[model samples]
Target: MKLKKVVLAVSMLVAIAGGTAQAQAQPVKNIVLVHGAFVGGAGWRAVYDRLTHDGYNVTLVQEPLTSFAQDVAATRRVLDRQNGPVILVGHSYGGAIISEVGNDNKVAGLVYIAAHVPENGETEADNGKKIPNSAHPFVKSSDGYLSIAPEYYHADFAADLPAAQADFEAHAQMPTNAAVFTANIPHPAWKTRPSWYMVAKADKIISPDLERLYAKRAHSHTVEIAGASHSVYQSHPDEVARLIEQAAQHALP
Candidate 1:
């Protein structure tokens, strides 16, 4: 009976040690994902799954595509929930939201996925105006909201995805307030935090050149995915997740 008790105690100690080690191995920082206009947090499933599988706590921010202020507030609400440091990620127009909220003390770094890394006082529309070859001019608006035309989905927005999926995404696209693009960002987080940027070479919604320009100004660690469309987040989840992991490592919790 004494021998049995000794063995059981040893087993319990081993299990406790293993659990502690596993917890320590997990990433210290959490990740908050923000989706751009015309879509919601559902679009971040692939990246979210990948990050969560890797043992990093991840939250997807479904910012109301109403106005920029509301989007920023939604992002902050998620940031406030994190226990330690956070890695804020934005895709497309979602990048703008992260830029506004990344200034929070909880955020350790910023990750832009085929997204706009706008400067303080600059509006999304301002970037659109300078990028003449961009697809912004082709966007349609009604009742103060803007959307991408279905045809552009296969041709430019999400060229990497299957045509059928693109068709569905275009049909279900989120309508964002058209005025949000022209609204100025007062505190651009990229200015203060370390940032990483990924650009889709064939992106149509925003010009590839403009992406590079934003990356350069922000001095972000930048990567370019050739032939990728604006929807590279969906087309290239692994690469996107990899970049976020790198940011988490570089950031201090």
Candidate 2:
């Protein structure tokens, strides 16, 4: 009888230890958000709030839309500060940025939000060539920066948003360097990393067909948000946050 009690106690202890180990192996707690062209890190506020509220250590990368290398470096800088494994996420042109940096050892998974994903030796522009974005006829500055014309910005990029907010976003838009579009990735990270993607069906800034192609090529688990424009992150913050949460919950250890 004593032997039986001893064995049962030993088994319970082992079970407790196993449970602790399983809890420690739960999804990564670090999340890094990267924003795409013609936008800044400020756009991630809603998503950031949701993530942080859920106990995630979230950081937003402010990529200078100057060049691809610079943007990659910016993301790398943020990644360098993470304490443990990370779930990297990018939006719009930011997708291309994460595809380059997600190769870091610290990255456990990647999430793309209405963003671009280029293959080796391919530029974002090259990826979109087969099906052009409908938000074209961009306004170009003398310095070679590109932006959506104010008159068309709301309709093209944020139609789902309130008119006032869309107008403000249009005027406050960050123009991307034209050279950034032509820069190619030498090593696309999606080739190795597990990935997730959100497709904005009503996106005019990037053809939905192209988004699907990129997701399919990366073999990423994908979700399509109907009627969501390029600003799906802003218009549907709850859904975006939920997807990121899912990535965090399922990321490999």
Candidate 3:
């Protein structure tokens, strides 16, 4: 009887260990991407293709850029549709969007790629003033919308991209409302969620120093892509996808 009891106990321990291993191996499969101002979700095509090819359920949020609240609501709508825990990603002004919306219960982790990260009560505009950007002056339309000058867009936003592609991007501009910059995040999700950050070393639109400061403040797992421009996600899709994959792999469901 004693020998039989010992064997059963050992079998139960093995079962428990196997179950734990399987739980740990189950990676987060959903990914939600948010794009910044002056651009739309179309910019995420390359990154989306890569992650989708690798079997991730990648969804992009097409922000209205009408207001900060609308952008956050758009992201929340996308998050609501995710079937399971999601790895949220943002670029440029999109980071501010995620920082506000990532508080959703379905969010497992966050990935910021050359993005802004504002603290409680801080606006991206406030941060911009503290760490001024190198990009050429922004052009404000009569309606109070902003866009980069076509002549300087290539150099300031996509210097790493081919000239032809950058030129097309320049002309395909999506002007953002100036009012969007003045909005502040009340409770940033980065304070509680696991986060990863990629800094574009040569970014001109948003200062790399500010990127570093945000990463450091958030205690995020950070990587630097040397010589990358503000369009790092488009210019270095492989690296950006890999870091996002890392976040997905490690995030708990």
Candidate 4:
């Protein structure tokens, strides 16, 4: 009887371990966020909280924004850690990074939030000229690094944010290599992967028209937020989170 009991206990342990492995191998409920230049992962704080509250494993990529190739490498490094399928998200210039990052096998879908959705052989700067909005005056480049003028952070960039907070973000901006914007993309992931886009209608930074054009070109499901500026992710975290959930749940089969 003792021998029989020990065998049953061993069998139970093996079953539990197998079950755990199977659970881990299931499709990932993971979401990886990539931030644009001039901002760190801190910008995703609200969105991160919302997704986490819903029981998602969330990872934020603090892309160095030093160079285009390096940014793509950084994003891929995070994707490498995911065990199952991943929903990749990008905000602002982060869209460009995702266009390349989504090519990874682990990626299920992509979400773009007021981001620069570029195509193969095209650079963000080149696309910018196609639309030719007046926001370029707000951008200042020094020593090959690009940064937005703090003066526009309130009126043009983050109109949805509180003045005090926007002020800090403006001054604490991360300067990206100007060449990164001019750097041509070799492969745009959106060409092959499913995508969703959120356009900040009131965005003076990237222009809503351009956002629409990019979304249309990529064949992305799109939502335009009225009166939202470039900081739409922070101002409307719920909407952004909902869209990401759609991609993770319904979109990623």
Query: How far does residue 75 in candidate 2 sit from its true spot (Å)?
Result: 1.1
Which predicted model would earn the best TM-score?
3
Which residue pairs in model 1 clash with each other? 36-94, 38-174
Please write out the lDDT profile of model 2 over residues 28-89, one tens digit for every residue.
89999999888889988999999999999999999889888899999999999999999999
lDDT of each: 0.86, 0.91, 0.93, 0.87
Q: Give per-residue CA lDDT, model 1, range 1-253, as digits (tens).
A: 9999999999999999999877655554699999998888988899989999998999998888898889888988888989988899999888888888888888888999988877777878888887745564446566778877787767767778998988999898888898778777777888889999998899988889999998999999999999888889988999999999999887662
Predicted structure 1: clash tally: 2
Name model 3 segments beyond 4 Å from true.
none
Tens-digit lDDT track for model 4 on 1-253? 9999999999999999999877654544899999987788998999999999998999999888889889989999999999788999999889988888888888888999999998878888888888865464646565778787888767777888999999999999898888778766778888888899999998887878999999999999999999888889999999999999888875443
Native-structure RMSD, model 2: 2.3
Which model, 2 or 3, shows the larger TM-score? 3
TM-scores for all candidates: the values are: 0.86, 0.92, 0.96, 0.87
- Global Cα RMSD, each model: 6.5, 2.3, 1.4, 5.9
Question: Against the hidden true structure, what lDDT does model 4 obtain?
Answer: 0.87
Instruction: Kindly report which residue stretches of model 1 are placed more than 4 angstroms away from their true locations once superposed.
Output: 1-27, 136-141
**How high a TM-score does candidate 2 get?**
0.92
Output the worst ten-in-a-row residue range by lDDT, candidate 1: 132-141
